[model samples]
Target: MITMPSIGDNLARLRRRAGFTQENLAERSTVSVSVIRKLERGDRDSASLPTLRKLATALDVTTVALFHPVPRFAPGNTDDRDDLYVMRRVLQPARALSGGGVVTLADDEDAPSSTDVWQSVREINGMFRDSDYAAGVAALPTAITYARAATSAAPEPHQATAWEQLAQTYQTAAMILIQLRKDDLAYYALGLAIDAAHQAGSDMLVASAVCSENWLLTRQARFNEAERAALATAEAIEPSLTRSPQSDIATWGWLNLGAAAAATRNNRMDVAMDSLRRARAAAHVAVGYRSPHVTHWTTFSPAVVAMREVELAMVTGDAGRALKAARSVPSSARPAITYQRFRLDVAAAHIERRHHDEALDVLLQLRATAAGWLRYQRYAHTLTSRLLRSRARAIPLELRDLADFLDVSD
Candidate 1:
């Protein structure tokens, strides 16, 4: 079967094969230097199609070539999805696995409702929310089994909640594995989430599944594809999905768009700006009292908004604006995973401004935080090493240590 490397892998490969560093690619492709940094790091998901075309043209390749599948574990081939996904999860030091025992989901072919199957799933989510990575990872197999079984079972209208629950479980598993640097496994699980959502025939379920998949697509840097998926999901569900407090389907769609826009290339600033405006409008519409889920998404404080703005500013080469936005991100509000990502963006912005000291400071923090998670992410280490070596400045000592640990050198 033909497969595509996630956007990050494809861009990195094309850039190197064309004998271009991130800086070189940034200069040629009209994509911001920070975007090049994130794309190569595998932390970003989307890029503007126009920018992609530029990069493709520069490499003397078609746009489709950017989506070419990366072979699994070929010698000198460091694009393995699994390693990358694992590294993403553990990159934050304070998020070490803590509690929650493994709970298995048994498949009963005769069962009519998926509710029983979802009990284990809820437990897993709780464990994850509590930062219990070990617990979440251990329970993943059971959740997958139950979800598959639920999908195969006969559907009952009353069992919609069960199916939704199952879909969410699969999504949760995907999220965990992605953070763990297991992208292939995460993709497989996300596929299951999509299947469960489809089978459930619930718009809310579908939206939730798409929300999760959107991030996965972004990591590959497939911005246009990811936005399409989000928009399609929203449009499909809007008419059927109620506008009540129970679920703010519209708001979710807008958030997805905002994120997608932030990932888009520097050349598409207008498109990105439009998407953010819509996102802000959607959030405004969601101000009234609502369900826990709706409130969680809609009322999610300005912190996430600020983060997106920082991303937008970085992509636009507005260092002052990006720094201003970055400063608005609440230190404690972000989880370790997201905080590390924010720092990387800040570092890139500093690099753009030629503030080497600031950039090195951010890089050091990343190194300190990311070292604990190194065992989980070979791909990130490889990319970071390459960036470090290619840059004119001396590599930070901490990152040097991390490179040695991963056995990856630029």
Candidate 2:
């Protein structure tokens, strides 16, 4: 028969691997030192689920890792095994390129031309839109390699296209890395993207890079810097904004949206609202024009504005307002990530209102639609834990299974 390691033993091993002493772990996880010591010594039979969650968050590992050994080549013991595999695969080409060797593609006839690189970039964007994150991850390594090769081998006039494609590929990688909570890696990727954009002499691409950087900063909880960077980038891009070019207007609008998100997180309600208004105005200017220079994965439309309002309301602790704003979101307009986030926010609002069944339903839908994506999100875990705690005796089998899959302690 197969056997499992005791929780204490597993916790101790993971703690050691993370380079934390008992006291260090206690301080970081906010569990008492005595409790940590007793748990490690196997003096305690079990820990509370919330306690386990704190330990997992503190160690930057999954709660499941506290119960089992982490797989090799994983992304720091995250719950999504497929995501880890995909990330490793996606990183291979970048790693190979870093080793001072030229990467060769399957079609060895000639190196990928600028057009080929652009087409690959578009494919990656399509994968993102389709919510096929794994496929996108699987495809990115080859695309990135081709982009890099094109930048070096293409004619001078065509080099800019190749560099722009390379920058876009890196930006996509950064987006995926941030979603995986690998902020440090995301920062590095964004830096590479910005450098490539500068080399391509594309001011618009540079602004896009800054917008991404602002996103990273916000995710890291550096709200002040995020707000400043986003607003400054928007202002810098303002000079190029014309009423006819929708891409410029959309890009400007998106930057302001970033600023508004940051401001909301920073508790600057007035600033946040003002930025949102500016974003809406810019979006209005782009209502009729069409351009190919837009950020393919994210567009600042009325639907996006409504979604931002929901987020802002949530941040400001106005659950009623948040729910009301959510109703304005055009279902067809949101990308996969945006739609998932909308569901999460709605679930949070429902929980706040004690509409437990509705909250659970939304969460279940999210899980069914994107199990791997849900696994990595703390908000999803928190909501599930809350529901389980509130209705422990009458919990449904489906929820129980979800809790087990999420590795919540009983």
Candidate 3:
């Protein structure tokens, strides 16, 4: 018979696999030694989400990985054929670019026109917003080639627009690549994006590129550099505030959001809060108007600022404050991805507070609303496993089915 391991069992196994003694893990995670000992010994039945997050960070693993045996198909597992195939495809253009080869459009009877390229870029941006990664990946290569061609072929007046389109396309590709954990490829794509933005000669576009660079840095765990990049970008564009206050405010607010996120990651709570305050001030000036420029997906509005505030609070280990801020975001103001993140934040806060049922409810809502999106997020698996382990009663059928779908065993 197959045996189901408890969370403690899984934790102990992962700790051993990481070659960390209890004392070492305790020191690294900043959890007390006694708590770590109790957890590994199964004497403690549950842990706060923040504590688990710290331990997972120290272990260089996702929190979900600490809850159960790593799946055969896990992303980093060499044996995962699907992962291997996706990684190969995602890295193809980056590898070619690194080797000093440009990706060319396949020979055809007619090349895509500038209008066609612009329309395609917009469609791909929509696909990204909808979280349709596969579709975006399928469309990207041709779009990239067409956008690059248009940039070179368009009239002087139209050249900047074409370059902006090309930059947006590359930025979209970088976004998808990062989500796939193909950070090297993502970095290459972002560099291309920045170059195109500079060629476009738009301060807004450059600021957008800087914002994306900050995001890449944050994902790579270079939090200090991410903070610096964001702050510099915001400052560089501050002079434009008088000429185009709304556009400048949007860009500035978005950069502050990035700065806040980086600060939060570095455990600089004061810095993070200060950044958020600046973002909030900018948002007030913009008054919820969306910038006409395609800001590389940076939306600056009151709601968006609040969303970042909630996220910062979560990162700072203030679950109550996070939940409170999340609740204040109006539904009309919440974009699809932002709403999804808000729900996840709510669930995370609940988990930290030991409100398992409430946490599960929020997760179930997310699953129902965006099952495909939720499936790929490691935190979803972590939250599900926590719920399963924390409750002594038989698992709810809905929760169990969700866990099974995510391939989370015990």
Better of 1 and 3 by TM-score: 3
Q: What are the models' TM-scores?
A: 0.58, 0.73, 0.74
Candidate 1: count of backbone clashes, pairs at least 3 residues apart or interchain: 15
What does candidate 1's lDDT look like per residue over 1-410, in tens digits? 32324667877887888899888887877667776666667654434334455777777886546545422332234464442333233222134554321221111323534445555565666544544454455334444445445555545654566666667777787776665555676787778777777766765666766776777777677777776777666555553233554246444634555445534662565666666665555544543424433111334334555666776677667888888788867776443454565666777777677776676666556566664343344444544555576567777676676566656666
Worst 10-residue lDDT window for candidate 2 reads: 100-109
Candidate-wise lDDT, in order: 0.57, 0.71, 0.71
After the best TM-score superposition of candidate 3, give how far the Cα of residue 248 lies from its true spot, in angstroms: 2.4
lDDT of 1: 0.57
Model 2 ranges with Cα > 4 A deviation: 1-103, 106-109, 130-135, 239-244, 287-298
Candidate 3 is scored at a TM of 0.74
The lDDT of model 3 is 0.71
Per-residue error for 111 in candidate 3, Å, reads 5.4
What is the lDDT, from 0 to 100, of the residue 266 in candidate 1?
26
Q: How high a TM-score does candidate 1 get?
A: 0.58
Per-residue lDDT value at 168 in model 2: 92
